[model samples]
Target: VNGQFVTDNGTNIFDIYKEELLKNPYTAENARIAASHYGSQLFDLAKNGFDSIPDLVLSISYQNGSLQDIGQKVNYGVKKTID
Candidate 1:
């Protein structure tokens, strides 16, 4: 959160996080969130600029073999709920 949350600037922060995520193994057992939410979180973090924010939301971790695996998991979960 040691940054600014300006509109264009926000995109850069999200891009960095995404780049980091993509470089890691998809099944690295790390937390993952929707790209949009990730972007939003980056925005919030930038705005906070290292300040403590009350009740910040965080993502949950899951083990996925690849991006395809992540997609399948999401699809399966949704299908199960719909069925």
Candidate 2:
């Protein structure tokens, strides 16, 4: 775990893993997959302008005084006519 805090004997301590922190999460395959899924839509949005596109909202909440306990909610959608 990188940049994570661990509780030991009722004490919270920062745990840093250099190797995990330095690892790259993005890969060529991930890029290709993202492009395959949203390339056309993104291009269209750029060309048409994002005025009509709905705003994306993300909400994150945590509880139990634990970093492991987390929740997220996302709202995203777009409506456009392509002809």
Candidate 3:
């Protein structure tokens, strides 16, 4: 989120993952899939997202240079997890 905290409903995805999935790979993968699904749901908000969101989404703008660069920097050299 924005500087280590979510500015949303206070439901921290990372915290939920840690509390529910951290100890088990299967559980973690399940959470990952759920996250993916939730992400896909963002298409309704717009392929990008509402302006209040902190980052651009994958499907809507995967190949743009600026977005790729941002993803690269934040993702430890990995870019475009989806596209």
| Top candidate by TM-score | 1
Model 2 — which ten-residue stretch has the worst lDDT? 12-21
Clashing pairs in 2: none
Please give the CA lDDT of all the candidate structures.
0.54, 0.42, 0.51
Error of 2 at 55 (Å): 4.6
- Backbone clashes in model 2: 0
TM-score per prediction, in order, is 0.33, 0.30, 0.24
Worst ten in a row by lDDT for model 1? 63-72
What tens-digit string does per-residue lDDT give for candidate 3 at 1-83?
44333437876455664556646767665776765675455434443447757775553333434333443434422353544
lDDT of 1 by residue, 1-83 (tens): 24644345455556666667767787224535655666777676767655666665544434343222332445433224554
lDDT of 2 at 49: 70
Model 3 ranges off by over 4 Å: 1-29, 46-83
Clashing pairs in 1: 1-49, 1-50
